[model samples]
Each structure stands twice: as C-alpha cells, then as structure tokens.
Target: MAGEYGLKRYFDADAARLLGGRIRAVQPGFDVEGYAAEVDSRIPGKELKDRVLVLAEGLRTRLPADYADAVPVLLAILGDELAEGEGMFTNSWFLMPVARFVEEYGLDHPDLSLDAIEEITKRHTGEYAIRPYVEQHYAPTMERVAHWARSPSHHVRRLASEGIRSHLPWARTLTMFVEDPRPVLEILEPLRSDGSEYVRRSVANNLNDISKDAPGLALATALRWMEESPTPETGRIVTHGLRTLVKKGDQQALALLGATGGEHVRVPRLSLTPGSVAVGDTLLIGFDIENTDGRAHRVAVDYVVHHVRKNGRSTPKVFKLATLELGPGERRSLEKSHAIREVRTRRYYAGEHTVDIQVNGLVRATGRFDLRT
Candidate 1:
C-alpha cells in the first residue's frame, strides 16, 4: 500500500485550480487557466518533490519575472499562520511549492527572501528554502537566523536550528557547518532551554547530525549543556544528540548517561522463539540480565541484529531495549518481538542472523535465527 500511496496525488489538477484561483484573487489579470495547464501538463509520473518543483516553475513563468516583484504576490497567498502543534502537511501543504519557488529564484534577493522565509515559516516551513541563503550569503543570513533563534514564534526558532543542520534530510548537506560546527553550536546555545519541545527537538537533531562527523565536539557540547543548563529540555537534547555515539558503545557517552559498569553485568540466557522464520513472520527474543557488581548500577540495555547482506556478509543494526536501575545482584527478564516485514529503507535476505544482548556498551549474550525467503 505504501507503493500505492503517492504524494504527488495531493498536487493533482484540483490543487492546481485552487492555487491558480488564489493567485488570481490577489493579482488581477493573472492567467489562472494558463498556470493550471502548466502545472497539470508536467505533473503526471513526477514524484512528490518534482511535482512541487513543477508548480514552482509554473509560478516563475506566470508571475512577475523580477524576484522582488514576485515575492509580494507569493506572500499575499499565504492565508494565516499555522496554529501551535499544526504540521505543514495539513493546512499549509500548498506552501511547499511556494517555498520551493523562493529557494529556486530568490538567492540574489536575500533581504526580500529572508523576510518571505520568516513569514512563510509561520504558516509552513522555511527550513529547506533558508538553506540557499545560508549557503550563499553566510554571515548576514546567519545573523538574521540568530535573530530568528530568539523570535517569539516557535516555528521561526525551529527554522533557526533546522535550516543549518549539517545533514538535513531531503536537503543538500551544509558542508560548511559539517566542516566546522562551532557557528551552528553558537546559534543552538540560546535554544537549549527553549520552552517549545518542537524547537528543542530540532536542536537535538542538529546536534545528532554534528555527532556523525564531529563526535568529540558533540560529546563535549552535550556535557557542557548538561552542566550549564540541567533542565529536562536540555537533558532530552543531550540524550538524543549523543544517540549514535552511545549506540557505538562509546564509554564516555555511556558514562555520561550513567550507563556505566556494563562489563560487570551478566546475561544468563538469550533465547529466540521460532529460531527459523519466513520474511513476514515474527521473531520473539527473550533475555535475562543480572547485575553482578557490588553496588547498584544503571543499565542501558540494547540488542543488535546482524542482518544478512546480498554478499552474505552481516551488517549490524542496533535497537533500544530498556533503561533501568538495578540494585546489586538484581535480576530482570525482558521480552521483545520483532516483526520482519517489507519496508522502503531496507531489503530482507535469507540467511542466519545473529542477535546480541548489549548491556550499557558491553555485549553480554548472543543468539541466532535463520531467515527463510
């Protein structure tokens, strides 16, 4: 059914007509039918993002040729700011094409574009559109972004962090920030204790992106945030930001989260029900952990699945299991069911797969399952 689902369907002919009508309402003598035809002709078979680009291109041809002249027309169509907790997909879905228009055409007009981005982000997202400005006009753009980091609107504040992510998904990577994340970190400083979880989550994701390239920097930043601002918000940010490092069993990261003394724990058994399964079947994993240390220990339990590749080699994927505080000699039983199904991100292969029980950063037990195609 996922294959059956197409995001481009939302931008079908009817959407073109609605957008055309909106443009006509704001600017008399606008060629509504011509705009609709332009978008409708090229949209079929195009993907979601491509469909959005088609709409943007249609606007570029139909609207005023000058970037500054076109901005007011584009802004006039933005209805209102999205309510708190409202996503861009629902009410502001039409703005996707509009945002893309700015990204494609508004580079030389930074002041106009940035102003439009600020207004557009309140209703939709300026995250993707703001990237070009950050890339082309680094200093002044980031100055405005820093100002946005303190904006009253959480959406704008979120953009301040989300726009400059080193590896923002669906957008080109910001290599400048990836090479040196100090500037991005400075912008994230004030937002560490932001009241909005939405903004804080973006801050976490930005740090997570940084961690992939600059682990030490991310770790030091997380530790500093924990020391300076010990709020629940910052704690979540640090925990999420250091997730990749923790999964790799980075001892310093484990210790920072109090998941220490992992080597002192013992997993008496790791069992797999239905040791063999087909692609659509479910595999049940059961394990018991005992804290063998003399003192109480905080445990971060995880499981690793070594999936079979086309070449018969195995690639390990980590899945979080549990986090608990265990008194000395305390024992706990845990059960997890994993469904082997079809998805876009990964393909399933038939072979023997190894599963490991990892306590903190240490592997305590291992088991195997045979997958049949």
Candidate 2:
C-alpha cells in the first residue's frame, strides 16, 4: 500500500514492523504486491484517509473473538505508539470493532467486577476507543472508579476522569452524568484535593460536568465544603471546578467567589420587551443596572425562565448573560436574545410565564410572559 501511494518511505520502523509481522504470520495469502501497487498510486493530499484506510483494512481481517482479552497488552504498547505529539490519541476507524468486541464480551461476563472492568477500560480508552463500552457499563465502570480512587497509581487515578468525562476527548457524550451526577461525584469527592495535580484536575472536571446538569447542586456542594472550613488547597480546587459555571451565571456558584449580590450591585430598571414569546419567537431580555459601590466592579447577569411542565411542575432554567463592568455610580444597558423552542420531553402551556434577570447572583429584575400556541 505504501508503494502504491508513494508513501513507502513514510512507513516508519514501528508501522512497518507491526504491519509486516502481522502480514507474515496471519495472512501468508496477503498481497504485499497489491498493497505496494496501491500505495504507489496514492496521491498527495490524502494522507489521513489513505493511512486510516490501510489500518482499518488490517484490523478488520485480524480482529478475533478473544480480541477484548488481548486488547490491554496491545493498547498499552500500541496506543502510545499511535498517539500524536501533543499526547492526544486519534480515533482511527478501527475503533468501532474494538467497542463491539468489548460489548459482546462483556455481555456474557456478568460476574466481571469493577477492578477487572477498569483494567480493560484504562487500556482501551484512547486506543481501542472503548468509550461506548464505558458508557454502556457506567455502573460497573463507576464502581471501579471508586476502587481506583484509593489506588497508588496516578495513571489509574487519571482514568477516573478520562472514563466518565462528559466531553472525554474524541468520544461519545456521557449524558447519564448530565442528569444524575451523584455516582461520579462520589468518585471525585474523595479525590478533590488529591496530593497529585493530575488527580485533582480530574476531580475538577467531574465537578464541571455536574455544573452543566445541576449548577445549583455543584455550587451547593462547593459551599458545603467551604463551610466546613476547607483547607486552602481544597478551596482552590473547588473554585477551579466551578470556574465555568460561576462565570456562566450560577448565582450560588459566584457566591463561593465572594461576590455579594445585594450589597455592591443593584438594578433600578429591568425589563423584557414583548414579555411573551412563543415557540419560534425571540425573547429580547434587557437589564438596567446601577453600581452604588465606591469602586469599579464587574456584575454578571442571570436569567431564570419559569418552565411549566405538562405534569404541572414548574422548573427554573437559568442562563448567564454578559459581564457588566461598571464604574462608581455608572449605569449600563445590556440586552440578550433567546429563541424559544419546543421541549422534547415536556410541553409548555399558554399561561403567565415568569422571567427574571439576576445581578451578582441575586434576582434584581423580573417580568411575566405568555407562551401561545
């Protein structure tokens, strides 16, 4: 293949050794001549596709029923071999087969405990690309995480985050954590102030994941730790974990940062134009603020939209607007736009809907609206 694509010289020693050995042992029938011819014919500007295709073809022919069992050794060695210079692994096309193998193998292994699962997942996470297996096996995977939390290996500790990250690199979204993050939090709480920066970073990311689903929960938990007189290091860890959400209008989140809602910031006039907007309509939210404090300050805006479910439970969805930088006695005008859309899991009714703009994590402005069909 390299010869055909004019990439014969580009075949590094590692690639040539592995691909050559596999060819000689597994497929004496393999067409080295055909591969060379194809490589010679390969054009420039198609390096990525051509290289990936060659790897995929090799994987498809060699993958076996017991592939999952062999994956750890292969990945431990080969994954580092395949990783890019920046330390990030690429999702080669052969990833799905590995996922399928684990899925199939795991189904019959009901007795597999957390520790065993971690051994496989840690090895294959970025190499065999076993994210689907990780997501599908979250319960056991998390149990493994709890066990690993006590391990002495930083490598294993890092896996705790790499495995369950909502946005794990080049992997599927782990939405289960988005709704209920308790299990993941359990694994992270003990490691929040880990002596290793590597482990601490993972704990911070796990907290960040929780912020997406329940910002208040994340903030409250941080507050609970703070109230317990967290060590300075733990305080820093919690603060870093909440950095994004606090900047994004988690009121309780900012409170952890020492922002006083009512003392330094005040809203004299706050309004929303066309207080009512239906699906496919735009809601223009405006906030007018006054900084009464003697010094300059940055006040963030938070919006809580009252969403009434079909079951009559009203839930508040909060969003953060721009950061308003105000000078002493200065007034500001800020506008935000939101497009209303139908809720997939819930329905909205035509009624007096409520919207409020909060300043410094405090509700300083509010208005009412109607959602018509």
Task: List RMSD in Å for every model shown.
Answer: 2.2, 10.4
TM-score of 2: 0.52
For this target, which candidate reaches the highest TM-score against the unseen true structure?
Answer: 1
Query: Which stretch of 10 consecutive residues in model 1 shows the poorest summed lDDT?
Result: 1-10
Q: Which regions of candidate 2 are displaced past 4 Å?
A: 1-57, 63-65, 72-130, 167-169, 261-373
lDDT of each: 0.89, 0.59
lDDT per residue for candidate 1 within 228-253, as digits (tens), equals: 98878788898898888888888888
What would the TM-score be for candidate 1 when compared with the true structure?
0.94
Error of 1 at 4 (Å): 13
Clashes of each: 0, 15
Per-residue alpha-carbon lDDT of candidate 2 for residues 188-231, written as tens digits (9 for 90 to 100): 76677677776677677767767877787888888776777568
lDDT accuracy of residue 309 in candidate 2: 65
